[model samples]
Target chain A: MDLVVAVLFQLIYVIANLALISLGLAIIFGMMRVINLAHGEFLMLGGYTVVVATNAGVNIWIAMLILAPLVVGIVGVIVERLLIRWLYGRMVDTLLATWGLSLLMVGLVTSIFGASTATTVAPPLGAIRIGSYAASGYELFLILITIVLLIAVWLTLRYTKLGLLARGTMQNAEMASALGVSTSRIYMVTFGLGAAVSGLAGGLLAPMTGVLPTIGATYIAKAFITVISGGSAILAGTTAGSVLLGGLNGIFSFIAGSTFGEIALLLAAIVLLRLMPRGITGRFFRKSL
Target chain B: MNSGILRQMRPTFVYALLGIIFMFAAPQVLQLFTIINLTTAIALAVLALSLALIWGYGGILCFGQVAFFGLGAYAYTISAINFGGSTWAILMAVMITSAFAAALGYFIFFGRVSDVYLGVITLTVTLIFFSLIRRTSGPEYKIGNALLGGFNGVSSPPINLPWNPTSFLFPEQVFYVAMAALILCYVFAGWLVNTKFGRVCQAIRENELRAELLGYDTRLYKLGIFTIGAGIAAIGGVLFCNGVGRITPDVFNLYNAALTIIWVIVGGRGTLIGPIGATFALFYLTSALGGQSVLNNNLVLGIILIFFVLLVPKGVAPTIIDWVNARRKKAPGRVRRRRGSRGEGAQ
Candidate 1:
């Protein structure tokens, strides 16, 4: 019973973590058809921002609250204006270009910060215990904040004028332009928003994983896998993908080992993709995007 | 445009011949260490050439050629160390690695995934392979021979060449061997590009639907070409292990994979020789500019890549070639006639 509880707790953590990152990917892919290979690097950038600021004597929470999203948003704008904008339509170019961008980001980080792994401290408060079982307050805070953000995003997308404009631009860019919606601005803003979300996710997760130069290198692939498996179109799929990947990852890591767990996850995801080309949640959001 | 005039001064081909001559003579002129580094660059170039062939001509854009390269590296090390020393061991290793690549490529290409998605699949496979290799440190699993050293990689005793003239002349002998192999690969690839198989592959790249409509099996060609490329990459890996005198999991990491991709991109892709030239030039540049000694080498590399992607997308070699062609075609009458035709077409 204790073992089951431990597994369930870990599964929840994994799902929440995966969903936070995958949500950013889903928005980018759905809004721009350009699979941002550098998405993980953006997450790493956000994590690093908080780390750098805190090390410079800023309060960790305050640093994250102020600098994380802003840094990522600025990077998004620069990347879009300089690189991503040129690769708007050509999918392969976008893939290669973003790959180049990813390499540049990693190289720059390594050069600037050195390759040594950096760590961040969690909030000083201890775990919140209920009976014999205890959970980190930090983890709970992350879950709550993510939940709040998810709801806020859902409500905004479903009931806002900007959301309508975004939806219009996503569904048919030329048609939206013909109907007088400014899609170029929408594209820029959506890219920035996606980067901001990635930053926010990074800030929340940094306490657990800390700040390594290649921090998001591992998560980038996982995020892409989650996004594809969950169906790029559905918010629910991102959640589903996160839970599926995170839970399977945690359980398998516990059982088989980290390497084998990763292998098994990959093998399962590939097999699943072969069986369901549209993805598991792709069915529900087939035409939504 | 008589054949003789074109043949009399093909600067590109002449430059290539000059490069081959210089590489062959490098061992005699340079120190032992420099010669070894050149050989290493040659081996890396061979692998990069394979990437360009697949990505440039076939339009497959595989970001995971290093996985195949790693497979080859492991295969050669394991077979030679365990099965006893023989040249045949190396040959078998290359063949097996090629077969593995073929199987993976078959499933991937025939699955009807689009080219863009194929890059994702290949990249995923590479990362998964990296993770799997790292995980084999546990006692439960062993990678082939007992020497498969997990993250530390596998190294072996000096290879006992069947026709060894002298054991101490290893570096010189290896340089000669690498040059001969490179020439053979270049000639074979160049000839293949003009063959029916190559023509069909190019057509598939140019227009997949038209090729399919014409009843050509596109997947077969992609698989065949990918297999060939993988086999070549394996050959390069074997050469690499032989030159380095050791192999580590680090040899097959993301950075190495990124380097291979950058080599092809920085060199012209469609032409086989482009990446071959690029591998040498870039490696030499890195060595000369103190790539390893620099504090921020990765950042410098990143900046270089970004610059190339933004301003030199056709790669350095192809851009230079284009400039040469333009200069040679600077006849006023010919230029006027071309402009006249363009103006007519616009109207």
Candidate 2:
């Protein structure tokens, strides 16, 4: 019984982790139809933000919660105004430009920090015992934070004027512009918001994974897989993809190993894509946001 | 003189002539080390040319061209070890990698999925290869006599003269082979785009639905070009390891993948020579950067990419070509027929 509870916690943690890393990518891709290949770097920037802040003796929670997102959000806006704004309609160009941006960010961070092993940013939370197994309280907190983050995003998109304007612009930019909405501003803000989410997730992840200039490469493929596998609808598709892929990965990793777990996850995604090319929500939650 | 084919192939012949001249001249003038570096650059140029064919011409932006590339290297290494000959092993390796590409492309092109997601699928597959190969440590990962070597990577057998299996090629001889292969592949690609099949592929690139409406199976055509591109890239893979002396899973990493795209983008996506030129230029540039400590290579490349995409979207070759044409127009000459226009002529 304790084993099941522990396993379930592990499964949920994995799901939440995947969701957290991928949510920002989902928003940008799902809403804007722009394939921001630099998304992993955005997350890495967030991690670095927390590292830089905490190294200067700031509170870890405040750095992760506030500073990381704020810094990366600003970076996202600058990226939009400088690079992404020009390559708005060209998806392929957007991918290439962002890829370059990702590389640039890695280079900049490496030059500043000096590329080496992981930076130390230890989680402050203690382990919480459940029956025979002890789980890191940080993992539980991450799971709870992921849920809260998802809810917050949902409320923002559903209730906020900015969200509505962003959605309207994405749906039909010309129509939104005709209706007096600043589509360009919306694009910038939406991109910034996505980056902010990525930043928060990265900051949150800093304690668990540590900060590295190239650390984004590790999460990038998986995050892209999740977002692309989720399809068009931002929230529901992301949740569905995380639950499915993350669950499969967790169970397989537990049964076999990390490598096999990764293989299974990729294989499942390829097969899933073969079946439903548009992604999970492309078929199931077609009506949902 | 009367045939359009000869006139059409004049520039290609000129390119081949220049390549041959360089192949002969460079070894005499440059040091052995420089020649060796040039060999590596040539192999990468071939890789870039492969992308120029598939993505540039066929309109298939394959993000994981390195998957087939790495596979070919590993396959050649393993087979050469087992067979004790590189000639058959090279053939076998190219065939195997192309078959793998065909299978993967089949799943993608025929799956009725939107084409935009193809990049993600290819990248995912390449990453899978990267991670999977990295974990192949220990004695358990040996194929026949060759160890998978895990992360250490296996050294490749040198390409020997086909008539004499015992006579292994020196580094200089391998450079000649790499240059010869590059020239042949370039001419072959130039010839291919003029064929009916290439014409149909270009039509599909322009408008897939319109090509489909004309009763052409766009999927099969894409699969064909994808396989051919894979085969050519496999050949590049074979030469690349010979130049570098070993094959590693790092070839399948995102860096190499991105670098390959950078070559094509900076060279000129739609033109063959553009990417080949870009590959050489950037290859040498990065190699020079690898020697230095002051600047980060990634940062430099990133800036170049952004600069090219924003300012010079048409890329180096087209920009130069346009400039020359503009100059020619300004000079006292009749408005001659435009040689390399946008669509098929871009090659």
Question: lDDT tens string, model 2, A1-289?
Answer: 9999999999999999999999999999987899888998999999999988998999999999999999999999999999899888899889889999998999999899989755689998999998999999999999999999999999988899988987788788999999999998998998999999999999999999988888888888899889888888899989999999999999999999889999989988888888888899878978888
The fraction of reference interface contacts (C-alpha pairs within 8 A across chains A and B) present in each candidate is 0.42, 0.72
Q: Write the per-residue lDDT of candidate 1 for residues A139-178, one digit (tens) a residue.
A: 7777677778777777767799988898888888999999
Candidate 2, residue B38: Cα displacement in angstroms equals 1.4
Model 1: lDDT of residue B83? 59
Top-DockQ structure, candidate number? 2
On lDDT, the candidate that comes out on top is: 2
- Which ranges in model 1 have alpha carbons more than 4 Å from their true place? A123-125, A128-137, A281-284, B1-20, B138-141, B162-169, B291-295, B332-347
Please write out the lDDT profile of model 2 over residues B124-201, one tens digit for every residue. Answer: 899889988999988988999999988989999999999577999999999999999999999888777767777888
What's the CA error at residue B272 for candidate 1, in Å? 1.1
